[model samples]
Target chain A: MGLDNVTVKPHEKLATALAPELTAVNTLIRERMASKHAPRIPEVTAHLVEAGGKRLRPMLTLAAAKACGYDGPYHIHLAATVEFIHTATLLHDDVVDESAKRRGRPTANLLWDNKSSVLVGDYLFARSFQLMTECNSMQVMHILSGASATIAEGEVLQLTAAQDLATDEAIYLQVVRGKTAALFSAATKVGGVIAGADPKIVQALHDYGDALGVSFQIVDDLLDYEGTGETGKNVGDDFRERKLTLPVIKAVAKADDAERAFWVKTIEKGKQDDGDLEHAIALLKKHDALTETRVEALDWAEKAKAALTSLPDTDIRQMLSEIADYVVARLR
Target chain B: MGLDNVTVKPHEKLATALAPELTAVNTLIRERMASKHAPRIPEVTAHLVEAGGKRLRPMLTLAAAKACGYDGPYHIHLAATVEFIHTATLLHDDVVDESAKRRGRPTANLLWDNKSSVLVGDYLFARSFQLMTECNSMQVMHILSGASATIAEGEVLQLTAAQDLATDEAIYLQVVRGKTAALFSAATKVGGVIAGADPKIVQALHDYGDALGVSFQIVDDLLDYEGTGETGKNVGDDFRERKLTLPVIKAVAKADDAERAFWVKTIEKGKQDDGDLEHAIALLKKHDALTETRVEALDWAEKAKAALTSLPDTDIRQMLSEIADYVVARLR
Candidate 1:
């Protein structure tokens, strides 16, 4: 759904390149998600795992391993571990966001209840840790567990910071760092670690994933104000939800007396009427916040691409660079 | 609070014997629960942690280590890790159960919101993994993560099996095994593992924790039907919640046609009226379920005490045996 317009989608290229490995990752995820005693565990897990989101994170893991000259099977295990963690977070996020739908379908929280989402999310997270431990790499466990903590801390930070009017860019970066980039960096870093790649290569992969994730999230935020597609989310959904996205934060930073009043009323207090969404968009445009946000996203994408300069020259490396470019391309 | 009246409290003996170590665990918990940016993390965690939980699980970890002749610093870390995991699960449990009062005060979910509880719980879980990794033991990691998965799976099984009349004691054991005993056993087993104890001693500690935990939970469930304490749980709370605890499971097993219809109307259909509580208790009494449940608890307690025969005959071991006996002593 993300790269439909590009004739040669970058992620699709990586997916095709690593198709066999990706298949093993998917199979491991399916095999591990099931509970012997609790049918509901598998039932709830299968609902989201089978929903067909592009397996971008796991592919990054595989690509990093193969590019680093790793041929072992543990990369497959690590890839599956990354996907499990991602799925678990999404499940919990649906409940936190009070989401009714995800990927154009009713969320598990809506279909079953919040209890199932919380427990099953927990189950998957625990399963992810178990998968990582099977690799016999304490470093992998250390890295993944640290990322897990960061991710949770980031979500909690967002919960506290999303509504406050005083949230600045540094705090926003921390929030995004915690929420998105932690897992991205961890996914790629563990791939290299598992492959026994050199520390320099592992660090390069980590830097690449960090930049790509930030760029990815920033583009996503920009798209909320820029386009409305059939990806199950509505235009101005973040606006109505009173989220302090990069665009909104930038707009509010430049707000005058009257405009500041509008942000406080709509965002801080959430007293929005029918015309408020249009008015918010107009303000974002007037402050040039949309264009500046897109530029920042492009800058991160460049960093992601540049991280690959020191890595081995391979088809997967080229595709990863292109993947970063394709992310912010939606905003451009 | 649980052992305030008993003259020879087993946990109190362990606490007195291991005061310095327990202090370290408490300090570590305080230091780790704090979030530099999100102050709400500690605020929610402290409300429960400082409410005086007797630190039973962490104490179990500490005692097992001491009994195995572990004179290292990592045991303190493991004890703190176990406590964090336990606290994290409780926070999520309160949210899942929609519980209002805990420890004679408002639950975190009630005070802040479900969002805060869920995210904060996640933070603690990740923090726990971080602490475990600090101990630098992969076997410890494997045991704890596995237990975490089983714990989540058990909660899910209980969620799905709670209202069904077809649930038997075997299923109940699996649920309790997952929900309660997994962590209990892992807590002690990891202590021995960290201490480099012999495998036989480690196995003994694992068996001891398992039976102790099972006995602990059965006593808890039985007490839910017998006592009303300042602890905030009311008698018959499980019945009101339509939970298929051991007593009710046994009662349902022997129900005649008329009784089955009654159970279906009250528990399955949930058309519970005013005398339903009394009637449920009467049915449990008619089946002599309370006495039989207490008997099962004693059997588990005996198994727990008997398992310690192969381990060192130290003061901690003696206290652990008494702990098992004291668990069922409440029912007696």
Candidate 2:
């Protein structure tokens, strides 16, 4: 998985192909994150933005635009805008999740305080809005702003849904779309829209991003339950947090009266004992929830690849398609 | 200040003059704040937005647009946008300040949790951005977005500066402009921009809002020290929180060595015993900081009125000018 390996990861390959634009996006991010009056703005944002998080969302923006024959400088602005939105969400998410660590490092909230995280996150959101306006396209602004609304709405929805026994797959999908897929779809759709791509092509880019994001999130949830020790995520962290992820939701749905009582106590009542995690895992296995979740993630990844078929067959597009497939490949 | 009183407050008078537009703005606010997916959004927002905070900022938008002879329907949207921004900031502010009360009610963070407050605040912010984009003016978007950035930057600055005794009047002014004046100026400027008013008229509106907001905040800080029990803000709340308002800043500037040590012990170290707040107030009087601060507020109010003289001499304009005077009149 290293950069020099022959079988380099899809996201790294995409980053290599979009190197110059990625550089421009990084420069723009550095320049924009600086505040003339508040030195803390850069300090808080730098912890997350400069952390090596693969820059996947922004690269998708650059890749989507380049695949649609966009040669203008605005794509750089859009890429940086996407990253700013991403970083802003991450900052707020840490505060919401009360997270102590992000990207395997101490989170901004831990380093400064929840106050800095909340306010600096706001500063990034404002910065993102300002950057999008630079593109001078109302259509782009419309899509990004709409995406922002959906993202926040999804998060609020998840807050209620994550602790409820009544939450089914449909509600889970809504939460996933709001928290994850909205930005992904917006990132890709705005790229094509800015490139003056045909409506159909832009629609295809949006579909690809949406499916890929869903697949990415499902796999992330799955990995938390099915850790290989290489992913850096502590297994059963979500369970300890009482968050009803896809696997737990599925297992609960298939639970009998006694198993339902277990879930009710552990999740809803939050009265789990030491062996409860082990019992939860056993129940997930008994119902084959992990396998079913993997199948769904793979299906979404396939849909993501299929949507990109209508895009130009450039190297960037090829890497994007592979990136979608790779998103769920870890499930194997 | 009651509606039927002939001596109705200036804001109430302005509200009477713009009743139809204000009604429309409320409708837009209610309509936009309700979320189809996240019921928590409306729940959390209604607790604050409907908590009777006077709607001063949105009223300014309506007044600015109507005074510029604009009869467009978009002012409703602009006014709603302003309120949404204000409400969103309040939501976040409560969480950042760890406040339990806002507008004489338990904060959303108290009723629900910090997570709900953070996410719902984000939703309102995103919703405001979407509402502004509907106005279809690049200039309006630029101004509002820039204000959002400034508001956040000022908040971050205040986070660091509030406890630092070295913070001067210049820094306090910058913080006030960011947290209050930025939105006020943007609210009024966008009204003029949406109305197709001349550049000079727009500048006047900007100036009026800027001065009014500064005066509004200065008087607010003054009330914290000279509380008549009518302001609803707890006297010595700012002192207890170690917030460095204008009077304290002035007093610190004129402090002797022992006075400086008292400020450092209370504000910098957050160590205070009984009568510390009383001593702080006494020091403020000893330095004549309260009188000086009151004079500055009156000066800003005068400037606010002076700026509005360039606009149309309508009843709405007269009410707006009166509102400016009434802001600082509480000091008398």
Candidate 3:
């Protein structure tokens, strides 16, 4: 139960450590998000970009690049690129999820319309591509663009998989990697790649980011069950949305006949009543699915830490390693 | 007024003229759209990509490249990249417009869902970026990425300006350029760039595409009033949707106080009544807006034709010139 090993401040330490670079990244983001003719670009993007995201992905980029000994200005560009991509995804995800709130504030889709969210998300994605190209490394472009494709693919897969009981851990991992870890790994990997690090070290960075993102998403899914975090909703938000997260997948896999019918009614048929969320949580508890999922997350966090061993023992690297552990530390 | 000047079959002649390149571009699109994990990608992409779009943007890439005397393999990739960008835009546009029909059938959003369309559009856009990167030309990426941003920015601008009474020709031109001409110009310019054409000639191709795209969109807006030519919607969709196209902008600019109130009631307030569309049409007719719009389209088409003269005289160039006039000729 000791908390000595974990760093509660995930992006906080990274932000302080990468202060100058983070400032440059923020400046770059503001400059790029501006539109001369269409003022709505900045308005919609500002709504989400200025909202209190931890700037975790962009920090990971800055940390990864700086820790690998890159001092060039392009790392700032890459960091901003990652942030733009993250914001774009959040905008589109809000629209797709019909989410009224994000970061405990009204979403752009709710404020302007779904149209603004969709188009502005696109503008940001296009902006991200422009930023990555500023790095002038085709290798970086390839990695980030590949990650962008995977992120969209992951989201589309989630759309279908979320409503199906046939989804399993394997499918869940793919979705998680696509929607979450692909960017994390790419964000970190491109950092090293842009820094011209060794292939093995870059691979190690990728592995670290992948594991961290997986653990982070697993904890997020778990938090939704334990009552929402910043999602600004009740516990079982995923259940209310009928998403097939790890805990429910495990629960459904082990459900009795009666429980199977309950899941079919709630998840498949989407006929949930007030008590359905309570009963769903009970079934997950009955199967110990939440506990198992937490253990898996911890395992991934350990892998993330292990991967960082290939990098130099810099302060930023140390922070990144601890951040991975903290990502899942909330689950415990 | 002679039918001999306008090739009744625009794409047919262009397709026959650019047969080999078109085949290769289609192959590249199919190859790139295939998802290793998500089957939904190709499913949704194919639903839109294969939905009979005339492949005009890609064809411009092919025609511009081939006409510039370049035999490079990357032109095919560039062509495919343009098509993917175009398809992606259409997908998102359908979702934004809540359009039930596109290309003479149900839109991808209608067949699948807004979620699929949004995610798949993101996928194709990413794929377009990926394909552009494979060309290993940062300049090409720069142009295409800029086009993508303009396209999205234009759409966002349209969302806000569509119902606003103050929207005028300048805003309408900006929107048209963003939503249509940016891609067309980028498609053509990249082709010439990839071919290592002369700087002036590359500029010429961009100019040609810009003009052609403007003329095409004007004709499209006109056809919506001249009774909907294959736009897959009934006449007055822009009126129904309150879209401030060029014709409507022209009419609004010339509106009297009483006419302004009619527009405000129908467009600004969405209090449309029966015969409002007919009254709107009569107002446009009375203002001579449709005729002036036709004159503007012809002027752009003429500009398009003039730009093509910079390129070497080849069959493809001739076809491109013909296509420009053909685009606006529909209105006449």
Candidate 4:
């Protein structure tokens, strides 16, 4: 199936199977967003939450829990917890990146102020903790809390690594895990744990989520370089921010001295303009970094699919495998 | 002995009692701060953690737990959790206030960058959540999470209240509870809960900590107007920032048309200069707002002492009562 079809099929089945749970999570999100003391919090949070981005993180949690035969009510709470954390990170990320847009909408920092974004993000984080506490499971709490710490560490790593061409693959993995995959892995892992799944099943869910998250982020990074008119984000978004993603890191590793000087001047020294993007793309192409990045993304997708072997041969598991395929199929 | 005698005694006894636990917490803090991918994480965190502010929040947890007659290891972990949260909030607060000095040293934002401060603050918050999870106590997690939410809400409330002289007692109370008292209350309450204290004693500790925190913040506000000589903070600091503290609110409430116009011109409109500080102080004196504020602080201190009545008349309880007195006694 195509990527859109794959997403649509699973979402339809999952929504019908977990409609009540999904409703609870939505209610929790609204209730938690309300602030009697700081009206600016809801104002900024609603700007982002209500702006129509897909509830992917929460969906991941719900799907994982359901796939593991979860029959309890706490999954809804965990789903909301995951979404709150993702939203909180997004608010801070926009401020750190100085990005004007997110999900084709004006970011919270852009609509309000960085101050509002930062504080509201913090409010959401606290709210997530509160929600997780309601689950009354220390194992669930540990999983989510550890995920939050990893996400923050990853973001910090990304911030410090930006514009430094010497950043290695290990650092790149840590940054991507923090910036994207940490939440995904945590969301799915917590879902399984809350369901009281067997340790083996929980581990399988975790590995699946981690590989899927890595694949998703790699595709996003690749799209920033090689995606055409179909992808909403423009090419060279990372280049504009002087972000040292996998492609740039790979390209730099393969560059000659003269090309290295050009990158240093344009990216590190912030001397880039419109033509610099074209030159950077040309350099990436010459180094085959784009092709290598695509291969790595596919490799992660296959790894994600392989993890599903440990899961039961349910429709959900099949759909998850297809989802991995869909992520890599985006490159086509 | 009276509360005064307890004030003279250093916290060495409490620290000694809690040493082994505190060491574990310190180890956790250190381990959480480590980021192999980001060398700057430790560098930035060390600048704040090593700056040597009193570990008052953590100590509250330790003291409360010990006072409740519990011998458990989790209290130290919870103590560190509170400290981490407090430290994270301070880093963010400095960035929000654009503050240069904290605890007689340059703020992290000044030494590093606001970006680093912001990210590191986030890192600390995540680490705090992780630390709280280590306690494996849902009650402790709930208390800390609720406090964290309240704290964030209070900050945003303060941000909106800044320069608005019409901010009243009710709003000010919410802000003070969120920004200061919430953490204090949580820190102490978690101690009692972890010690398996009864609900009544837990409530007592919570009330005592809340009252003490309110008194402490109010005294800090009062000192901004009346303090001199090695307190180190500038006098009229609130006036310069146009902060609507208790004194400012009371003074504005009692203002005549002429004084109100002056306030509108100076504080609300941000037209204040060095001379405006003198005029504002003169207005405060004319309305006796300074005296009123001092009286309010004393009232809170009395309330704090009264809250301890439920506790057994032990030395630690007595010392806690005295600590409350010492907080407000600075005004006398």
The candidate that wins on lDDT is 2
Q: Which prediction has the highest TM-score against the true structure?
A: 3
Please tell me how candidate 3 rates in CAPRI terms. high
* DockQ score for model 4: 0.73
Clashing pairs in 1: none
How displaced is residue B12 in candidate 4, in Å?
Answer: 5.9
Global Cα lDDT for candidate 4: 0.84
Candidate lDDT scores, in order, read 0.89, 0.91, 0.89, 0.84
Question: Of the candidates numbered 1 and 3, which has the greater TM-score value?
Answer: 3
lDDT value for candidate 3? 0.89
Once superposed on the true structure, which residue ranges of model 4 sit more than 4 Å away at CA? Answer: A1-20, A227-234, B1-28
Tell me the interface RMSD of model 2, in angstroms.
Answer: 0.4
Candidate 1, residues B96-115, lDDT tens digits: the string is: 88888776788999999998
Candidate 2 residue lDDT tens string, B195-246: 9999999999999999999999999999999987667777887888899999
Error of 3 at B27 (Å): 1.4
lDDT of 3 by residue, B1-332 (tens): 32256556776899988888889888889999999888988998888788777888888998998898988799999999999998899899999999988867888888889999999999999988999999999899899889999999889888989889889889899999999999999999999999999999999999999999998899899888985555564688899999999888999999999999999999999999999999999999999999999899989989999999878988888889888867876664
How far residue A168's Cα lies from its native spot in candidate 4, in Å, is 1.8
> Candidate 2 residues A1-332, lDDT tens each?
21223255777888888888899899999999999999999999988888888998998898899999999999999999999999999999999988887767888999999999999999999999999999999999999999999999999998998779898999999999989999999999999999999999999999999999999899999998998766766788788778888999999989999999999999999898999989999999999999999989988988998999899888888888888867876665
Query: Under CAPRI classification, how is model 1 graded?
Result: high
TM-score of 3: 0.98
